[model samples]
Target: MTNTHAAAADGAEPPQGPPAPNHESGTGGAGGKTNPAEGRVPTTHPHPKTHRTPDGLDAHLVVNRTTFRLDIKLTAAPGDVVALLGPNGAGKTTALRALAGLVPLTAGHLRLDGAELDRTPPESRPVGVVFQDYLLFPHLTALDNIAFGPRCQGATKAASRAQAAEWLARMGLTEHATAKPRHLSGGQSQRVALARALATSPRLLLLDEPLAALDARTRLEVRAQLRRHLAEFEAVAVLVTHDPLDAMVLADRLVVIEDGRAVQEGTPSDIARHPRTDYIAQLVGLNLYKGHADGHTVRLDIGPAITTTEILSGPAFVAFPPSAVTLFRDPPTGSSARNHWRCEVAGLETHGDQIRADLTGELPLAADLTTVAAAELDLHPGAPVWATVKATQTHAYPA
Candidate 1:
């Protein structure tokens, strides 16, 4: 099932929450202590002109077919990396195709390096794309595949191969230059694909699920390598993926798509801290509350008092990660944190070394604890538990 809904092509800020970036490796955990990029999110407000296009690549896209449609707006700076993140049917791929001119635009404008390209053909658009499968020709050697693009652009054959050799060496594929695509491992093939794309000298690069085909063990190593390559490339790069960890790790900003619309967009840390949709909430594992802020507290529907450092005076959001919530089989005393509720454990899920308990109480919330902690509490789906969270840890900000 493909999602053809319209999403925000224009980048914007996502809701705020506990610092998402500062979390550890893997998607997320209940009580992981370290974040790869600690404090990756900025706590300040955006400037009045914060939306200005970067490196002069401004794109507005609306693409439609009989069975699917996509609309989005985006602008990128010379070295900025933007990620389009969504579930399978979220229209991320359709949006990318629209920008590359692989699919015709029903409406909207695209400008790269100050030149309008909405009407340009794919070959003329100065854009490079790395497909999900690392679609190199099986018969062609890695060197030849890289040289293919340059040669097609009118460089002499020898010159093209020389340039190809240079790129292969740059990618640490020097020893594998003569190996055909069939002999290349997943990571090697990916590098060859990337090198080939870059050899075309695109001003904007589009990568679609660049690591989806690799085995689990390879994703981590390749991702780290990809991050370095993206950082070194002096141009805007937009990648599409569903993995929140990947977006947070590989990109400077994220555009979250749900059913075709960009429900939220921001830095990985921003989205992680404050997820706006139920989809995002589940993806990041947090209890998200939205309401008005006046004086010392934010009022919820079936409200509880939340104390916070932020004192915004109007509509706002309050959020906290599951690990911040403490659970007990029985109500416990001697705690300073103000918020608590008694609830039945609706469900229990085990992931890696931790257990996630979904609680149905006055306020429905999820709690993360170590397997040992869960065992210590003798937790089960039907068990009763008291849940608690500190007001100070519950982040609050203007909605």
Candidate 2:
């Protein structure tokens, strides 16, 4: 049977009010010509309840290629921001494209506010996309780039520019409106791209790695700005990103995809505290192990037994952070820790203010210590050490 789940954001709401005036003209005209007097775009932004489905978006997308297949389901309320997160080539982008109508779906359904969009063309769908590269028209000025969407929806040049101006002001890019794409900084260009997408006031917004183009410092600033804009948006938003921090910060919920399918989906805190897969565990910076459990003892599949406070049975998973591990130059004669493994230091590196030591031995693990401690122990690669963790430090849950 196919897996289908309805994941709701904590405070998601149904479509509210008359849609912001700056984004009211969501649909555009037939040949890029504005319909005078009517002043409205041809597209539909029906009240969410009018459609009869759920309040936000409900989609089951399946895309098949000769080399790969992607099948995933998604649901979000009007005010929710859902982040599609995974490693490279994990089908996060494919799912975003399918939702945008850029890639056709082989099967399943797509609906927004009760409208079936599986057969809708890209331009007709009430959706906007911000690609990783920004995809700005290099030849056009910032104002024109943002105005292009409004113009396509049949607004007059004057009307479109007026709307574009509002979006630019909101993005704090009014000063750069006349600048061409090449002249704008990466962060400015990204803001413009976002403004262009939002100019149409789409009922559903799709962003593909929105901050991947900016440098470290710029990313920090842009991420904060993007988060503020998203909170004010009264529509469903989905963003694709490989950065776990980005997903955790900007999204109300995270959908972790692996091997073309959604392996896990939940609020960021929930997934971080209880990751179900090794990839997620590593992404969240935890050492995870699978084992067979008998009461409080778990025999790891890789040949080690761990004692935990939780009395779980059958298959189980154990997780602990690198900080929970302690390293000693020699095995201690009388230690309160219940777990001990003789390991050889494979490598050492600075992790923030602490030093992280990579070890290989009876059990591979990462241990964290202070720089002064490392210097006192004269720690280095190829050094032999004993690693131990108290039973209380490890968390155990049924697999």
Candidate 3:
């Protein structure tokens, strides 16, 4: 495979972690300086002062391709792990590349710790990356692989190896120091890749699908380890992944991107509880609807009105989980469920132990049922059914 790792410039200092940037000084003030800019790059439009955090990352990245454009504003305090989440072709990778300087910005600025990095070369920027594949040099031992960054930044061979050894020990991989990439297990290789990335002590760390390459069992163990490592990192970290579990577990905040734009951003629970877009709704496994709210009832723009526990007037959103929907072969009268929709089974698939039925009709939604329940109803594509949800099961929030 191709080598994609890059190193910081010579004589750069490892970040000392953050107390928080001092806004008045335009650098890490009382908070120890993480990565100080070598020199300022002149810019016609400086990053907005309101968004500048001298101990973190503040960027409005805009990359224009012939057929697609990615425009997203990302901001994170030092010690923050932010995830860019979306489906395929949703520009998550494009945003990561922009942060790494692999792709030039068509518009907007890239600033880290209040210094402009819009024009910095990839190799010169104080950033590190952990690619999906780890990209360890196939010919190098684990120790050499972790030492590569420090060596490139002008560390003496002995000093570089020593630093790499320290990282390997920290990652609990000292025993595997002499092992090559091909000799290490998936989790060990991932830890080696992470140690390599952190070995340079980058101010901004970008991970593109860090857990994508691991098997299920290995991913479980490695994900926990990665989370701990990320938590201990003192610099800003941006993670790109489509897996909701990874984003929810590893990131301090989430920016949900779709069609080259951010559709929603918030804490994992906040985004899961109140999704602003269908993509987010589906990612979090909730059925979301946009409508105008009057009191406790929201009349959807297209589907049937839903009654929610929240009393609000104006544009709002209603969401419920697939488990909240109870399907019936026939519409029942005198039911406690405040909302019911006649739907046709569009498709059926196994979602864990339950069968997830994709239904379409008055309201498009997903419903989960036990195998026994599905068999009892003889559920299949094109089968008509009634789906009911209690008002208490639906959550409503402002649009």
Candidate 4:
């Protein structure tokens, strides 16, 4: 990756031409003023003054459609990789498109490096986008695909190809450089997309479900490679993904969106340790309950009261993993666990090597037990069982 960066910096000189006027606002181009002598894209916009912003990328997009409305705020530093994580139709892609200037914002601002870019066209914005499908040109070889960006930026064909070759080597795809997109593997194609985006020297990079097209094994390999590249990126990067592990592993911070709004934004550890919404909780693999808290107990709205170690008042939330729950065919005669619920097994399924029992009765919860224990208890749907959890196993926090 370092080699790729060095090669891009060394191979193609910056764009050289008469500074194109910023056509959108009848003002000079922002952050992309061209210099004929140096052939470099200005790091800062013209009207906004030449100064770096505290935030590399700052946006508050509001788009209203007939059926869906998207409103989300995003901020990141120059070296930060922020992931927009949510379930399908959560507007992750819409937000990415808005940032890339592909979608119009009905309201709010878009700024990069202290320059306002709300009106900039997609081609004029100092942004690069890698779409979910890789979107490689089928007729273009991997080398030509990577060189496409530099060529658009006014690099000579030879210079662009040289830069592309360097990036191909860095991505370990030099051998496949001459192969067209259709001939490349999913992982290789993904790398080509990434190289093409980076070759533009964008100050703001957007990737939408960058690995969604790959198979499981290919995804694992591509994810690691993408993470390394993202870390080495000098500017702000925003990636949209529904995969919890991808968001946690690849991003410096996470912005969880639901129904077009940001529900939570924090470091991965912060979100994993304390999920605020049921969607987030489930995504992180924890059972979440909302209820009212009095002292060390929470009375769930679902009719179950959970005992926890934290003392709290008013509305609260309690979460515990399925593994924290224990199941018994009969109520234990002498159990120290303070939280117990009588439940009937609604269903059972294999979760890894353990059997996950979904229960419904006094309290609805999921319990995970070893297959051996499940067999010993003869656990099956419609069977009655007692679920127990020590109060210490649950975490309670203010709602």
Candidate 5:
């Protein structure tokens, strides 16, 4: 939008632009921190399971307007956490809204458990949602907050409060049941939000950045707790998150959407091992290469071929973690690894204890080395280095 074309026209390739998620700056940490909870109450969720839905959580999502269009499909089963991962403006939320019945489907079918839900209104659809902000009522106690859903579903006031108590106890918020939303902590509020949604017992559960509001310390705890809850859920649960780590840990499978289209969909490990797009490649912090594998070696279209432990017969992918690459200040006269490349350090950034160096050469790649190694090589933004990767370190799978 800022005339990025001008830079490309001037002999420079366009930038990758801002990272998919900048939530770390405000509340979420740099891949390590998360957002603080915003207060709110909500309804049903899903769990993680190895089983697949034979019929799937069928959806042919279609929403059209003068400004944009959405056409996509998502199918999963009960107990499978399907993460919708993408950058902003990728229509991830739009597709979720369509399935939730908040946005009308211009033309498509939304079926869950063999029932037609697309034609139904949001309230009529037994779907639960945990929004980015945990919109809890400031005046209500956490117990009442969790119980609000059941009361709306026709339970008596006393029974609802009782059910809310049970849920609060499960979330480890029994002591804070009487506390108002303002009196609660971010992590507690998130649990309350999740509790409220699950109280409704929805056949389909939706979460949008569930842990995006927590800090680093709280994120670790909440992530583990959320994983437990998802494991407990027995219905269809779909979560939309920008963080790759969250998607991998919270969801059973991933459905990546970009520009309102389904770019890729597979198990988190599957997608991580064989990334088709640069976005997915960067998210997993891996050097991905598409190549042909035959017998003992895999060949890339680029400068060097990669050898792997597993021998494949056809098209395959060779991937290695950034840390697996070793950098040198000069071309090594002798090296143990067969795969080596000379590259210019295009950029460098600190990721926790190590620094990730983005290199430019025969092929753009990111390599991670410890601070000691980095200092030894005197790595800098424009320094040249020789990188070597051991054959045993490379992982190859069918492309």
Candidate 6:
């Protein structure tokens, strides 16, 4: 992290740290370019019969760098928490930075509460960013760190401190107001960083991997707290994270990005149940395949046909959980499962309390079984096996 980016400055700019690749050069001459597919997808995925208010966030961020290009549209209503979820180097941070005005847009617009902020400077925009590291000023006490934003916005010194104190109380950090950043725990520092971001009453809040810095034990507690806080927030909040759990738990909607573009956007449950891409399928722990559906079977592009309960036609997707697959040492003639494949165990790994076997041969798939079952079958790499999944367990959806 560079010292410039790591500085715990108020929203005048992003928190100081190591510079990001996409932020190296701001946009130039990007205004003339247009994305042909931008209109193909709707701006927001509102619940059935619900209408998104116009007085919220509407942004189509585009940044053209030498090595990367980010072109994704984001929209949210007040009180909506949207998560930009993807893998590393998928432009999640770039999208967050563009929204924060830290990275200029090459071609697209940013609007909040009916105001166009495409050209607004970081300090002037109505945005607050909580960095991944929770960059609290090393020299300042918790109270002062929270007060910094309001002070920079021209609030009276005493008034800012009072507001900071109120926030500290609200965050259950009143006892830590006098402590410096170094003296605070990871969770405490995160709360302080959140308090600082909220001190200025930003209309839009941006969080970059808000829980990435916490350990497993602390993450559980803080994640619950963060969810509550996000639920209570009245404005739009956009979170950038590679962790699927964080996105699923924190956001009302998930925008799945990959290679700098949005591949899917939907409610957490909807996305989990009907993943559109392999990346999302893996993230949600499903074995997904695209194929042509006929009657009750889907002929996958790569693997053998899978018989599903759903009767669909044309392009379709079939998905089933690894746990739904049952592996046998030999092919059974009287098995009731409608889908069966002669597969070879390619690898084995411990997944939670189960053994996940990655198999190849007639059909590639992952099967999850108990350690006892694995031992009974003597499962190992290169072992011949028959994998079966009940037709009722596979879900088929249109592609």
Candidate 2: tens digits of C-alpha lDDT, residues 231-327: 7777788989999999999999999999899999999998998888989998998888999999999999996899999999999989899999988
lDDT tens digits, residue span 64-144, model 1: 778776778888887789999999988998887776665778888888878888876554556677777766756668887
Off by over 4 Å in 2: 1-54
Provide the TM-score for each candidate, comma-separated: 0.82, 0.85, 0.86, 0.86, 0.81, 0.87
Say which prediction, candidate 1 or candidate 4, comes out ahead on TM-score.
Answer: 4
Candidate 3: global Cα-lDDT? 0.78
List the lowest-lDDT window of 10 residues for candidate 3: 39-48
Of candidates 4 and 3, the better by lDDT: 3
What's the lDDT for residue 26 in model 2? 29
List runs of model 4 lying over 4 Å from the truth: 1-53
> What is the lDDT for 317 in model 5?
76
Better of 1 and 3 by lDDT: 3
Most TM-score-accurate candidate: 6
Q: Please identify model 5 stretches exceeding 4 Å from their true place.
A: 1-56, 65-68, 292-315
lDDT of 4 by residue, 86-136 (tens): 989999988977886667899999999889989977556677667666667
Clash totals for all models, in order?
14, 4, 0, 3, 19, 8
> Lowest summed lDDT over 10 consecutive residues: which window, candidate 4?
34-43
TM-score of 5: 0.81
- Candidate 1 overall lDDT versus native: 0.71
- Model 4 scores a TM of 0.86
Tens digit per residue, CA lDDT, model 6, 1-399:
122233224232332322211111111112211100000001121112233345889999999999999999999988889999999999998998788777889999999988999987555566777776775767678887766655554555677678778778878999998999899999999988887766656677888888999999999999999898788777788899999999999999999999999999999999999999989999999999999999999999987899999999999999999999999998778889999999999999999999999999988889999999999999999999999999999999999
Give each model's whole-structure lDDT: 0.71, 0.78, 0.78, 0.77, 0.73, 0.78
User: Model 5 over residues 1-399: C-alpha lDDT tens digits?
Assistant: 112243234332322321111111111112322212211123222223434445549898988988888888888877678999998888888887776666778998899889897666455566776766776656568887766555545555677677788778878899998998889989999999888777666677788888999999999999999998887777778889999999999999998887788888999988987787667887888888887888768888665678788889898878888988888888877788978888899999998898999999865688888888888888889998888888888888887
